[model samples]
Target chain A: MQRATLNRMTPYAFMAPAAIVMVIALLYPLLYMVWGSFRDWNPAQTIGETEFVGFKNYITLFYDPAFRESLSVTLRFAVIVVSVEMVIGVGLALLLDRNIRGMSVLRTLFILPMMIAPVVVGLMWRYMYHPTVGTFNRWLKSIGLEGVDWLGQNALMSVIIADIWQWTPFIFILALAALQSLPRSALEAARIDGATPWQQIWHIKIPLMMPVLIVTCLLRLIDAFKVLEVILVMTEGGPGLSTEILALRISRTATEFRELGVAAAMSNYLLILLLILTAAMFAYTKIQEAREARIRAAAEEDM
Target chain B: MPTIRLDNLVKRYGAVEVLHGIDLSMEENEFTVLVGPSGCGKSTTLRMIAGLETVSDGEIYINDKPVSHLEPKERDLAMVFQDYALYPHMNVAKNMSFALRLERRPKAEIDQKVREVAEVLGLTPYLHRKPGELSGGQRQRVAMGRALTRDSATFLFDEPLSNLDAKLRGQMRAELALMRQRVHKNMIYVTHDQIEAMTLADRIVVMHGGYIQQQGTPEELFKRPVNKFVAGFLGTPPMNFLDADIVERDGTVWVTGKGFELALDGEHADAVRAHRAKQITVGIRPSDLSFDPDAANENSFELRVIVSEYIGAQSVLMCDCGGQQVVVELKSETPIPLGETLRFSVNPAGVHLFDKESENAI
Candidate 1:
C-alpha cells in the first residue's frame, strides 16, 4: 500500500517545481496587475497606501481618444501585416519547394532574417529609411527621382513593412516544412487526374495546407499584438502617434505619464483581447480533434 | 480509346540512366501489364506513359500523335497510385467530383457523375466520409471511384491493390477485373506480381535489368517462354532445372543427365542436332510430373518422397530425384508413406531446353 501511494505521489513531486514557478513567475504578476488596475495609484506609492478607485481607470481609458486611436492603430497593423505575411510566406514556400542546385543553402539564407535579433533589425531598417543619407533616399536621388520622407509621411507603413520583413521569414520556414511533408503520391495522382498547375495549387496544395496555415496565422497575430521593440526603435511612437501601437502606449503610460493604475488597466484590456484570440485558436484545434474522433466512432458504429 | 506507343523511351537522372531505350506499342482498350522485379524500370515506364516522368530520349505517340511533351492534364489520363492517394480532407463524393468541378461542369451533371461512379464502386454509403474515416477496402474503392469519374482516354494503375490484406486483395482484384470489362479504356498497369499480370492483362510485357525481355499474350509467354527467366518466373511451384546434355542414341535424341534419360520428339531433333554447345540445361514444370504408382511407363523416375504439405483438397509432395529436388502436386487421398520411393511419369510436351552459358531457351 505504501509503495503504491509513493508511486502516485512521485509525479506530483516532480511537478511541484513547475507549479511553484508558475505561481511566482506568471500568476503573481498577473494577480498584482489585476489588483493594481482597480486602484488610483501613482508609481511612487506602495500598494498598501494606494486607494481603490472602482473602475475609474477603465472608464477614463474608454473616453480617452488617444487610447482609442492607439487601439485602432494596433488592430490595423496586426491585420494587414499578418495577411500580407501569410500570402507572401506561403507563396514563397510553394515556389521554392523543389529540388534544385543549392536549394538548401537558399532556404537557409531566406530564414536568416528571422534568426537576427529584433532590435538589430529595427536599427538596420531605420538606417535604410533615413530621409537624406539612407539607402532608399540615396538611390532615389541618384536615379533623378524626388525622395519622399520614409519615416515622416509613411511611418506606420514603414514600421509595418519592417515587421513583415523580419517576421515573414518565420512563416516561410514553417510553410516550407508543411509543403514538403505533403504526400508525393497525391500530387502525382492530381497530375494524372487532369489538374493544371494552377488548379493543383488552388484545389489540392492550399486546401491541404489550410490547417497548418490557420495555426500559423493565429500565432503571427498573437505575436503582432505584443510587438514593441522594432516599432519603438524605428518610430519611437512618433510622427504624431502614427505608429504608437498598444504595447508602446501601455509602456508610455506607466513610465512617462507616471500612471501605474491606468497602465495596468490598459494592459488588462489588451490581455482580454489576446485571450479571445488564444481561445479561438484552441477552440479551432479542439473542434478538429473532436471531428476526427466522431468520424472514427461513426466508422466503428457502422462496422 | 487511343492506342499507346512508346518509341525508344528513355529516362535519365542527372548521370545514371534507369530506363535504357524501351519500345512498346499497346492496342486500344487493351489491358497491358508491365511486370518485373524491383528496380527493373517497370514503374518508370508506366509513369512516363502517364506523363509523370519526362521522356529523355524518344517520343510517346497516342493514336499516332506525339505526346511525350504534353502535360498529364492535356493527355487526359487517370492513375491509381500504389498508396490509394485519396484526398484526406474531402469526403468521398467531393473527392470523386474534383475533376468535374474543376472543369466547371453544371452542378447537376457533376452530381450525376459522382452518384453513378459511387454506386458502381459501392462507395455510395460512405460518400460523406473522409479518407481518414474509411477502412482500407473502402479507401481502395474510393480510389477506384475517383478514377472512374474521369472519362479520360487512358488509365494508368501503379499497383493499385498492393496495399490490401491478402484476402481483401483477392476480392479487390476480382472487382477490378469486372470494372475493367465495364469500362474499356486504354489501360496500362504496373506490378511485380506475375499472377496479377496473367489474370488481368490482354498483353504482358516482361521486363528485366532495364530492358524488355518479352511481350506477348499471357498464354504465349507461359507456353512458349522466350528465355529461362520467363519460364522460371511464371509458375506457382516454379520450374525445376537440371544439368543435362543432348546426345544421339541410335536414331533419336536423348537428354542424358545424372538422373535419367528422356527421348526428344521429332520436332526438336534439328534444333538440338545443330546446337553449337556440347552442354545444355533442361527445364521441367512441377505440374508436368504425375505420380504413376504402377511404374510401367517410359521416361518414368523413382522419386523418393521426403515431405508432404497438405493444402486443403490438394497436397504437394517434395521428393528427391537422383539427388535433385522435385515437387509433385496431387490429390491428398493418394497416400504413400513417407520415405517410400514412388514412380512418377514425365510429359514430353512440358520439357524445355536451354543453353547453359546463355540461359536462353533453345
Candidate 2:
C-alpha cells in the first residue's frame, strides 16, 4: 500500500520544482499587483505603509479620457497592424511557396526584420523616417516630389507601419509552413477541376489555412496589445497622445506620473483584456479538437 | 468526348530526364491505363496530360488542338487523386460542386449536378459531411463524385484506389468498373498495380525506366508480351524464367535446361530454327504446370516440392528444378506431400521463349 502511495506521489514530486518556480516567478507578482491595485501606493513606500484606497484608482482610470484614448489607440494599432500583416504575409507566403532557385535565401531575407531587436528596429525606422535626411524623404526629393510627414501628424500610422514591418515575417513563415503541409494532391486535383490560380488560392488554400491563420492572428494580437518598446523609442507619445498605446501609458503613469496604484490598476485592465483573448484562443483550439473528435467518431460509426 | 494525344511528350527535371519521348494517343471514350512500377513516369505522364506538369518537349493535343501551353482548367479535364484529396473544410456536396461554382453556373444547376453525382456515388447520405468526417471508402466515393460532377471530356485518375485497404480496394474497384460503364468518357488512369490495369484498362501501356515497354489489350499483353518484363509483370504469381539452350535432337527441337528438357511445339520450332541465338530463356506461368505422372520425360520436369502454401481453393506450391525456383498453382485437394519429387508437365501452348541477350520474345 505504501509503495502504491509512493508511486502515485511520484508525479507530484517531479512537479514540485516547477510549481515552486511558478508561485515565485508568476503567482507572487500577480497577487502583489492585485493587492497593490486597491491601495494608493507609491514607488518609495512599502506596501504596508500605503493607505488602502479601494477602487479609487480604478474609477479614476475608467473615467480618464487620456486613458480611454490610449486604450483606443492600442486597439486601433493592433487591429490595423494585424490585418495588414495577415494580408501581406499570407500573400507573400502564397507567392513564395515554390521551388524556384535562391528561394531559401529569399525566405531568410524576408525573416531578417523579425530577428532584429525591437530597440534596434525602432532606431532604424526613426532614422529612415527623418524629415530631410531620411531615406524616404531623400528619395522623394530626388524624384522631384514633396516629402511627406511620416512621424509628425501621422505618428500612429508610422508606428503601426514599423510594427507591421518587423512582425509580418512571423506570419509569413507560419503561413508558408501551413501552406507547404497542405495536401499536394488536393491542389493538383483542384487545378484539374478547373480552378485558376487565384480561384485556387481563394477557395482551396485560404479555407484550408484558416485554422493556422486564426491562431497566428490571435497570437499577434496578444503581442500587439503589449507592444511598447519600438513605439516608445520612435514616437515617445510626442506632439500629443497620438501614439501613446496602453502599455506605454501604463509605464509612463508609473514612472513619470509617480502613480504606482494607477499603473497597477491599468495593468489589471490590460491583464483582463489579454486573459479574454488567451481564453478565446484556448477555446478555439479546444473547439477545433472537439470537432475533429466528433468527426472521427461519426466516421468510425459508419465503419 | 475529345480524344487526347501525347505526341513525343517529354519531362525533364534539370538535366535528369524522367520521362523520355512518349508518343501515345487515346481514342474518345476509351479507358487507357498507364500501369507500371513506381518511378516509371506513369504519374508524370498523366500529370502532363492534366497540365499539372509542364511538357519539356513535344506537344499534347486534345481534340486535335495543341494543349501543351494551356492551363489545366483550359484543358477541360478532371482528376481523382490517390489520397482521395477531398477538401477537409468542405462537405461532400460542396466538394462535388466546387468546379461548377467556380464556373459561376446557376446555383440550381450546381445543386442538381451535385445531387445527381452524389446519388450515383452513393454519397447522398454523407453530402453534408466533410472529408474528415467520412471513412476511407466514403472519401474515395466523394472524390469520384467530385470528378463526375465536372462533366469534363477527359478524366485522369492517379492511383485512385491505392490508399484503401485490400477489401475496400476490391469493393471500390468493382464500383469503379460499374461507374466506368455508366459514364463513358476519355479516361487516363495511372496505377502501379497490374491487376487494376488488367481489370479496368481497355488498353494498358506498360512503362519501364521512363520508356513505354508495351501497349495493347490486356489479353494480348498477358498472352503474348513483347518483352520479358511485361510477361513477368502482368500475371499473378509472375512468370517463371529458366535458362535454357535450343538444340535439334533428331527431327524435333528441344529446349534443354538444368533439370528438364521440353520439346518445342510446331510454331516455336519454326521460330527456334529461324532464330540464330543458341541460348534462350524459357518462360512458363505457374498455372501452366500440372501433375502428370505418365508424361514423356522431355515434356515433364521432375521438381522437388519445397513449400506448399494452402490458399483455400488453390495451393501454390514452390518447387525446385535443379537450382532454380519454379512455382506451380494447384488445387488444395491435390495430395502433394512436402519434399517429394513430382513430375509436373508443362503445357506446350503456354510455353514462352525469349532471347537471352535482348530479353525479347522470340
Candidate 3:
C-alpha cells in the first residue's frame, strides 16, 4: 500500500517545483487582481485601509463611454489586423513554397520584419508615414502629388498597417512550414486526378493546412488583443482613442487615471475573454482527437 | 483506347542525364511492364510518360497526337502510386469520384460510377470512410478504384505492389492480372521485381544503366535473353555463368571450362563455328542441371555440394565447380548427401554462350 501510494504521488512530486513557481508568479497575481477588483482602493493606501465596495468599480466601468469606446476600438483593431495578416501571410507562403535559386535567402529576408523590436518597428513606420518630410510624402512630392495626413487623420489605419507589416511574417513562416510538410504523393495523385493548380490548392492543400492555419490565427488574435508598444510609440492613443487597444487602456487606467482597482477589474475582464478563447481552441482540438481515436478504433476492429 | 508511343524519351537534371533516349510504343490495349534494377531509369521513363517529370528531349504521342508538353491531367491518364496515395481527407467514394467531379460530370453519373467501381473493388462497405481508416490492402483497392473510375485511355502504375507484404503482394498481383484481362487499356507498369514482370506483362522491357537491354514477350525474354544482365536479372535461382573457352575438338565445337567440357550441337555449334571469340562465358539455368551418375565426363560437371535450401517441394543446392559457385534446383525427394562431389549433366539446349569481352549472347 505504501509503494502504490508513493507511485501515485511520484508525478506530483516531480511537478512540485513548477507548480510552486506558477502559484507564486502567475496564479497569486491573478487572485490578487480578482480580489482587488471589488474594492474602492487607492494606490496610495494599504489594502486593509480601503473600504469594501462590492462590484462598484466593475459597474462604473461597465457604463463608462470611454471604456466602451476603447473596447470597441480594440476589437476592431484585432479583427481587422488578424484577418489581413492571415490572408497576406498564407498567400505569400503558398507563392514562395518551391525550389528556386536563392529561395532560402528570399525567405530569410521576408521574415526580417518580425525579428525587429516592436518599438523600432513603430518608429520606422512612423517616419515612413510622416505627413511632409518622410518617405511617403517625399515620394508623393517627387511624383507631383500633394502630401496627405497619414498618422493624424488615419491614425487607426496607420497603426494597423504598421502592425501588419511587422507581424505578417509570423504567420508566413508557420504556414510555409505546414505547406512543406504536406504529403507529396497526395499532391501528385491530385494532379493525376485532373485537378488544376488552383483546384489542387482549393481541394487538397487548404483542407490539409486548415488545422495549422486555425491555431496560428488564434495565436495571432490573442497577441493582437494585448498589443501596446507599437501603438504607444507611434500615436500614444491620440487622435481620440483611434489606436487605443485594450492593453493601452489598462495601462492608462492604472497609471494616469490613478484607478488601480478599476484597472485590476479591467485586467480580469480581459483575462476572462482570453481564457474563453483559449478554452474554445482547446475544445476544438480535443474533439478532433476524439474523432481520430474513434476512427482508429474502427480500423483496428475491422482488421 | 489510345496507342501510346514514346519516341526517344530522355531525362536530364542539369548536366547529369539519367535517362538516355528511349524509343518504345504500346499497342491499343497492351500491358507493358518496364523491369530494371534501381537507378536503371525505369521510374524516370515512367514519370516522363506521366508528365510528372519534364522530358529533356523527345516526343510522346497518344493516338498520333503530340503530348510531350501536356500536363498530367491533359494526357488522359490515371496513375496508381507505389504508396497508394489516397487522399486522406476524402472518403473512398469521393476519392473514386474526384476526377469525374473535377470534369463537372453529372452528379448522378459520378455517384453511379463511383458505386460501380467501389463495388467492383470490394470497397462498398467502406465507401464513407476516409483512407486513413482503411487497411493497407483496402487502401490499395481504393487507389485502384480511383484509377478505374477515371476510365482514362492509359494507366500507369509505379510499383504498386512493391509496398505490400510478400503474401499480400502475390494476392494483389493476381488481382491486377485479373483486372488487366477485364480492363483493356494502354497500361505501362514499372517494377524491379522480375516475377511481377514475368507474370503481368504482355511485353517486358528490360532496362539497365539508362538503356533498353531487351524488350519482348515474357517467354521470349526468359528463354532467349540478349545479354548477360537480362539473363541473370529475370530468373529466381539466377542463371549460373562460368568462364570458359570455345574450341573445335576433333571437328566438334566444344566449350571447355575448369571442371567441365560440354559439346555444342545444332544452332549453338553453327554459331560457335562462325564466332571468333576464343574466351567465352557459358550460361546455364539451375533447372537445366540434372543429376546423371553415368554421364560422360566431357558432357558433365562434378561439383561438390555445399548447402541445400529446402523450400517445400523443391530444393536448391549450392555447389562449387572448380572455383566458381553454381546453384542447381532439384526435387527435394532426391536423396543426395551433403559434402559429396556429384555429377550433374547439362542440358544441350540450355547451354547459352556469350562473348567474354562484350557479355552479349553469341
Candidate 4:
C-alpha cells in the first residue's frame, strides 16, 4: 500500500517544479495586480501604505468619457484592421497559391514585415508617415499630387493603416498554409464540376478555409486589443487622444496620470475582455472536436 | 452525347515526360476504363480528358472540335476523384446541387434534380448530412451523386472505388456498373485494379510506362493481348511467364523449357515459323492449368505444390515448376499432395507466346 502511494506521489513530485515556477512567474503577479486594483494607490507609495478603496477606480473608469473614447478607438482599430487584413491576406494567398519560379523567395519576402520587432516597425512607419519629407508625401509630390497631412488630421486612419501593413502578413502566411493543405483533389473535382474560378474560390475554398480563418481572426482581434508599442511610437496618442488605444491609455493612466490603481483596474477590464474572447475560441475548438468525435462514433456504429 | 477523342495527348512536367503521345477516342455513350499500375499514366490521361491537367502537346477533340484550350468548366465534364472529394462543409444535397447552382438554374429544377440523384444513389436519407458525418460508402455515393447531377456530356472517374474497404469496394463497383447502365453518357474511368476494368468497361485500355499497351473489348484483350505486359497484367492470379525456346521438330512447333514442353498448332505455329528469334516467353493463365495425372508431357506441367491458399470454392496453389515460381487456381476439392510433383495439364487454346527480346506477342 505504501509503495502504491509512493508511485502515485512520484508524478506529482516531478510536476512540482513546473507548478512552483508558474506560481512565481504568472500567478503571483496576476494576484498582486488584482489586489492592487482594489486599493487607492499611486506609484509614489508602497501598496501596504495605500488605503483600500473598493471598486472606486472601476466606477470612475466606467463613467469616464476619455476612457469610453479610448475603448471605442481600440474596438474600431481591431475591427477595421482585422477585417481589412483578412480580405487582403486571403486574397493574396489565393493569388500566390499557384506554382511559379522563385515562389519560395517571394513568400519569404512577403512575410518579412512580421519578423521585424514591433518598436522598429513603429519607428519605420513614423518616418514614412512624416508630412514634409516622408516616403508617402515625397512619392505624392513626385507623382504631381499635393501632399496631405498624414499624422495631423487623419492620425487614426494613419495608425490603422500602419498596423494593417505590419500585421497583414501574419494572416497571409497562416491563410496560405491553410489553403495549401486543403485536399487538392477536391479543388480538381470542383473545377470539373463546372465551377468558374471565382465560383471555386467563393463556394469551395472560402467555405473550407472558414475554420482556420475564424481562429486566426479571433487571435488577431485579441492581439489588436493589446497593441500599444506601434501606436504609442507612431502617434503617442497625440493631437488630443485621437489614436489612444486601451493599452496606451492604461500605460498613460499609470505613469503620466500617476494613478496606479486606476491603471490596474483598466488592465483588469482588458484582461476580462480578452478572457471572454479566448474562451470563445476554446469553446469553438471544443465544439468542433466533439462533433468530429461524434461523427467517428456514428460512422463506426454504422460499420 | 459528344464523342471525345485524344489525339496524341502528351504531358510533361518540366524536364520529364510522364505521358508520351497517348492517342485514344471514346465513342458516345460508351464506358472506357483506363486500367494500369500506379504511375502508369492512366489517371493522368483521364485527368487530361477532364481538363484538370493542361495538355502540354497535341489536342483534345470533343465531337471533332479542338478543346485543348477550354477550361474544365467549359469542357462540360464531371469527375469523381479517388478520395471521393466530397465537400466537407456541404451536405450531400448541397454538394450534388453545386454545379446546377453555379449555372443559376431555377431552384425548383435544382431541387428536383438533386432529389432524383440522391434517390438513385440511395443518399436521400443522408442528404442533409455533411460528408464528414457520413460513412465511406455514403461519401462515395455522394460523389457519384454529385457527378450525376451535373448532366454533363462526359464523366471522368479517377480510381473512385480505390479508397473503400475490400468488401465495400466490390459493392461499390457493382453499384457503379449499375449506374453506368442507367446513365449512358461518355464515361472514362481509371483504376489499377484489372477486375474493375474487366467488370465495368465496354473497352479496357491497358497503360504501362506512360504508353497505352492495348485497348479493346475486355474479352478480346483477355483472349488476345498484344504484348507480354497486357497478358500478365489483366487477370487475377496474374499470368505465369516461363522462359522457353521455340523449336520446329517434325513440322510441329514446340515450346520447350526446363520443366515442360507445349506443342503449338495453327496460328501459333505459323507465327513462330515467321519469327526470327528462337528464344520466347511462354504465357499461361492459372485458370487454364488443371490437374490431370494421365495427361501427356507436351501439354502438362509437373509442379511441386508449395503452398495452398484455401479461399472458399476456389483455392490458389503456389507451386514450383522446375526452379521458377508458378501459381495455379484450382477447385478446393482437388486433393493435392504437398511437396510432390503433380501433373497439371495446360489447355492448348490458352497458350500465349511472346518474343524474348521485344516482349511483344508472336
Candidate 5:
C-alpha cells in the first residue's frame, strides 16, 4: 500500500514547480487587476490605501465617447485586417504551391516579414510612409504623380497597412503548409473527374482546407485585437483619436490620465472580450475532435 | 466509346528515362489491363492516357484525334485511385455529383443521377454520411460510384482493389468483373496482380523494366508465352526452369538435365534440331507433372519430396530435382510419402524451351 501511494505521489511532485509558478505569476496578477478594477486606485498610493468604489470606473467607461470610439476603431481594424489578410494569404498560397526552380528561395523570401521584430517593422514602415522623402512619395513623384499625406490625415489607414504588411505572412505560411499536406491522389482524381484548375481549387481544395483555415483565422483575430506596438511607434494615436486602438487607449489612461482604476476596468473589458473568443476557439476544437473520434469508432465497428 | 492509341509514348524524369517508347492501341469498349511489377511504368502509362501526366515525346490519339495536349477535363475521362480518394468533407451523394455540379447541370438532374448511381452501388443507405464515417469497402464503392456518374468516354483505374484485405480483394474483384459486364466502355486498368489481369482483362499487357513484354488473350499467353519472363510471371506456383542440353541419341532428340531426361517429339523436336545452340533452359509448369510409378526415364522425373503444404482440396509439394527446387500442385489426399523419392511423369505437350543467352522462347 505504501509503495503504490509513493508511485502516485511521484507525478504530482514533478508537477509542483509548474503549479507554483502559475499561481504566483498568473493567478496573483489576475486577482490583483480584478480587485483594482472595483476601487478608486491611483499610482500615488498602494492598493490597501485606496478606497473601494464599486462599479464607478465601469459605469464611467460605459458612457465615455472616447472609450467607445477606441472600441469601435479596434473592432473595425481587426475585422478588416483579418478578412483582407485571409484572402491575400490563401490566394498567394494557392498560386505558389508548385514545383519550380528557386521555389524554396522564393518561399523563404515571402515569409521574411513574419520573422522580423514588430518594433523594427514599425520603424521601417514609418520611414517608407514619410510624406516627401519616403519611398512611396519618391516613387510617385518619379512617376509624375502627386504625393498624398500618409501620417497626417490618413494615419489609421497607414497603421492598418503596416500591421497587414507585418502579419500577412503568418497566414500565408500556415495556408501554404495546409495546401501542401492535401491528398495528392485526391487532387489527381479531381483532375480526371473533369474538374478544371479553378474548379478544383474552389470545390476540392478550399473545402478540404476549411478546418486549418478556420483555426488560423481565429488566431489572427485574437492577435489583431491586442496589437499595439507597431501602431504606437508609427502613429502614436496622433491626428486626434482616429488611430487610438483599445490597447493604446488603456495605456494612455493609466499613464497620462493618472487613473489606474479606470485603466484596470478597461483592461477587464478587453480581457472579457478575449476570453469569449478563446472559449469559442476551444469549444470549436473540442467539437471537431469529438466528431473525428466518433467517425473513427464507426469505421472500426464496420471493420 | 472512343478508341485510345499511344504512339511511341515515352516518359523521362530529368536525366533518367523511366518508360521507353511504348506503342499500344486499345480498342473501343475494350477492357485492357496493364499488369506488371511495381515501378514497371504501368501506372505511368495509365496516367498518361488519363491526361494526368504530360506526354514527353509522342502523341496520344483518341479516335484518331491528337489529344496529348488536351487537359484531363477536355479529354473526358474518369479515374478511380488506389486509395479510393473520396473527399472527407463530402457525403456520398455530393461526391458522386461533383462533376455534374461543376458543369452547372440542372439540380433535379444532378440529384436523380446521384440517386441512381448510389442505388446501384448499394450506397443509398450511406448517402448522407461522410467518407470518414464509412468502411474501407464502402469508401471504395463510393469512389467507383463517383466515376460511374461522370459518363465519360474512358475510365482509368490505378490499382483500385490493391488496398483491400485479401478476402475483400477477391470479393471486390468479382464485383468488378460483374460491373464490367454491365457497363462496357473504354477502360484501362493498372495492377500488379496477375490473377486480376487474367480474370478481368480482355487483353493483358504484361510489362517489365518499363517495356511491354507481351500482350494477348489470356489463353494465348498461358499456352505460348513469347519470353521466359511472361511464362514465369503469369501463372500461380510460377514456372520451373532447369538447365539442360539437347542430345540426339538413336534418331531421337532428348533434353538431358542433371537428374532427368525428357524426349522431344513433333514440332518441338524439329525446333530443337534447327536451333544452333545445344544448351537451353527447360520450362515446366507444376501442374504438368503427375505422380506415376511405371513411367520411362525419358518421360518422368525422380524428385525427393521436401515439404508438403496442405491447402484444402489441393496441396503444393516442394521437391528437389538434382539441386533445383520444383513445386507441384496436386490433390491433398494424394498420399505422398514425404522425405522419399517419387517418380512424376512430365506431359510432353507442356514442355517449354527458352534460349539460355537471351531468355527468349525457342
Candidate 6:
C-alpha cells in the first residue's frame, strides 16, 4: 500500500518544480492582474490602499476611440504581416528546395534575420529607417528620387516593413523544413503523370504543405498581435495614433496614463484572443491525429 | 504503340560511370524485362528511358524519333515505382484521374475513365479513400490503376512487385501478366528476380556489372546459355560445376572429371572435337540427374549420398563426389541409404561444357 502511494506521488513530485515555477512566474502575475483590473490602482499606492471599482475601466475603454484605433491597427498589422509572410516564405522554400551549389550557405544566410535578439532587431531597423540617412532613403535619393519621410507620415508602413524583414526568416526556415520532408517519389510520379511544374505546385506541393503552413501562420499571427519593441522604438505609437498596436497601447495605459485597471483588462482581452488561437491550432492537430488513427484502425481491422 | 530503343545509352555520376553503354531495341507491344542483381544498372536504364534520368550518351528512340532530350510528360509514358508513390492526400479516384484532369479533359470523360480502370483493378469500393487509408497491396493496385487509366503508349515498371509479400507478389505477378495481354503498349519491367523475368518477359535482358550479358527469349536463354554465369544464375538449386578434361577415349569423346567419366553425345562430340582447349568445366542441373542404379557406366556418376532434404513429394539428396559437392533430385520413395556410394545417371542432352578459364560455353 505504501509503495502504491509512493508511485502515485512520484509523478507529482517530478512535476513539482515546474508547477512551482509556473505559479511564481506566470499564475501569480495573471491572478494579480485579474484582481487589479477591478481596483482603480496607481503605481504610487499600495495594492491594499487602492479603492475598488466595478467594470468601469473596461466599459470606458470600449468607447474610447484611441483604444479602438489601437485594436484596429493591431488587427490590420497582424493579418497583413502573416498573409504576406506565408506566401513569400513558402514561395522561397519551393524555389530553394533543390540541389544547388552553395545552397547550404544560401539557406544559412536566409535565416540570419531570425537569430538576432528582438531588441537588436528593433535597433537595427531603427537605424535603417532613420529619416535623413537611412538605407531606403539613401538608395532612393541615389536613384534620382527625392528623400521622403520614412518614420513620420509612413510610420505604420515602416514598422510593418521592418517586422516582415525580421520575422519572414522564421516562416521560411519552417516552410523549407516541411518541403524537404515530403516523399520524393510521389513528386517524380507527378512528373510522369503529365503534371507541369505549376500544376505540381498547385496540386501536390501545396496540399502536402498545408498542415505545416497553417500552423506556421497561426504561430506568426499570435506573435504579430504581441509585437511591440520594433514599433515602440521606431514610431512609439506615433504620428498621431497611426501605429499604436495593442501591446504598445497596453503598456502606455499602465505606465504613461497610470491606469493599471484598464491596462490589466486590455491584457486580459489579448490573452483571451491568443487562447482562442492556440486552442484552434491544437484542435486542428488533434483532428488530424484522430483521422490518421481511424485510418490505421480500419486498415488493421481489414487485415 | 511506339517501339522503344536504347542505342548505346550510358549513365555517369561525375567521374564514375554506372551504366556502361547499354544498347537494346524493344519492339512495339513487347514486354521486355531487365533482370539483374542490384547495382547492375537495369533500373538506371529504365529511368533513362522514362526521361527521369538525363542520358549521358547516345540516343533513345520512340517510334524512331529521338526522345532522349524530351521530358517524361512529352514522351507519353507512365511509370509505376517500387514504393507505389500514390498521392497521400488525394482519394483513389482523384489519383487515378490526376493526369486526365491536368490535361483539362472533360469532367464526364475523366470520371468514366477512372471508373472503368478502378473497376478493372477491383478498387471501386475504395474510390473515396485516400492512399494513406489503404493497405500496401491496395496502394500498389492504385499505383497500377493510375498508370492503366492513362493508357500511355509505354509503361515503365521499376521493381513494382518487390515490396509485396511473397504470396501477394505471386498473385500480382499473374494479374500483371493478364494486364499485359490486354494492354498492347510497349511495357518495360525491371526486376532482380529471374523467375519474374522468365515468367513475364517476351524478351529478357540479363544484366551484370553494368553490362548486358545476354538478351533473348526465356526458352532460348534457358536452353542455350552462352556463358557460365547465365547457366548458374537462371536455375534454382543452381548448376554444379566439376573440373574435367576432354579426352579421345577409343574414338568417342569422353569427359573425365571428379570421380566420374562420361562419354559426350554425338552432337556435343562434334563441338568437343573442334575445341582446342583440353581442360573444361562440366555443369549439370540437380534436376537433370536421375537415380538409376542399373544404368551403364558412361552416362552415370558414382556419388556418396550424404544428407536428404525432404520437401513434400520430391526430396533433394546432397551427395559427395570425389571431395566436391553434387546434388540430385529424386522421388522421396527411392530407398537411398546414407553414406553409401550410388550411381545417378544424367541425361546426355542436359550436359553443359564450358572453357575452363573464360567461363564461356564451348
The recovered share of true contacts, given per candidate in order, is 0.65, 0.74, 0.72, 0.76, 0.72, 0.70
| Tens-place lDDT digits, model 3, residues B1-362 | 68988899888999998888999988889999999999999999988888899989999899999998999999999999999989888878889999999999999999999878877888888877888888889999999999999999999999999889999999999999999989989999999999999999999999999999999999999899999999999988999999998888788888888987888876998887778879999999999998889998767899899999999899999999989999999999987789999999988888888989999999
Residue-by-residue lDDT tens digits, candidate 1, A15-104: 999999999999999999999999988989999999999999999999999999999999999999999999999999999999999999
DockQ of each: 0.49, 0.55, 0.55, 0.53, 0.52, 0.49
Q: Give lDDT tens digits, candidate 4, residues A1-303.
A: 999999999999999999999999999999999999999998999999999999999999999999999999998999899999999999999999998999999999999999999999999989998998899999999999999788889999999998898899999999999999999888887888777889889999998898899889999999999999998889998778789999999999999999999999999999998898889888988998788667645754674
Q: Lowest summed-lDDT stretch of 10 residues in model 1 chain B?
A: B293-302
TM-score: model 3 vs. ground truth: 0.95
Can you give the lDDT of residue B44 in candidate 1? 91
| Candidate with better lDDT, 4 vs 5 | 4
lDDT of 3 by residue, A135-209 (tens): 988999999998878889889988999999999999999999999999999999999998999999999999899
Q: How well is candidate 2 docked (DockQ)?
A: 0.55
lDDT of 4 at A165: 89
Clashing pairs in 3: none
Interface RMSD of each: 3.5, 4.3, 4.0, 4.8, 5.0, 4.5
The Cα error of candidate 5 at residue B345, in Å, is 1.4
User: Pairs clashing in candidate 4?
Assistant: none
Models 1 onward score TM values of 0.93, 0.96, 0.95, 0.94, 0.95, 0.92
lDDT of 5 by residue, A259-288 (tens): 999999999999999889879888987998
In terms of lDDT, the poorest run of 10 residues in model 3 chain A is A294-303
Question: What digit string (tens of lDDT, one per residue) describes model 6 on residues A1-303?
Answer: 999999999999999999999999999999999888888988889889998898887888889999999999999999888888888899999999989999999999999988888888888887887877888789898999987788888888888888888888889999999989989999999999998899989999999998889889998999999999888877888988999999999999999999888899898888888899889888988998788668755754674
Tens-digit lDDT track for model 2 on B1-362?
68988899899998999999999989999999999999999999998998889999989999999999998999888899989888888878888998899889999999999878877888877876778878999999988888999998888999999999999999988888998999999999999999999999999999999999999999999999988999999998999999999889888999998988999989999988898679999999999999888888878889999999999999999999989999999888889989999899999989999999999999
| lDDT of model 5, residue A161 | 89
In the order shown, the candidates' Cα RMSDs to the true structure are 3.0, 2.6, 2.6, 3.1, 3.0, 3.3
Segments in model 1 whose C-alpha atoms lie over 4 Å from true places: A1-16, A46-49, A282-303, B258-261, B296-298, B302-306, B321-324, B339-341
lDDT of 4 by residue, B30-49 (tens): 99999999999998888888
lDDT tens digits by residue: candidate 2, A37-135: 999988999999999999999999999999999999999999999999999999999999999999999999999999999999999999999999999
Worst 10 residues of 2 chain A by lDDT: A294-303
Clashing pairs in 5: none
Of 4 and 6, the candidate ranking higher by TM-score: 4
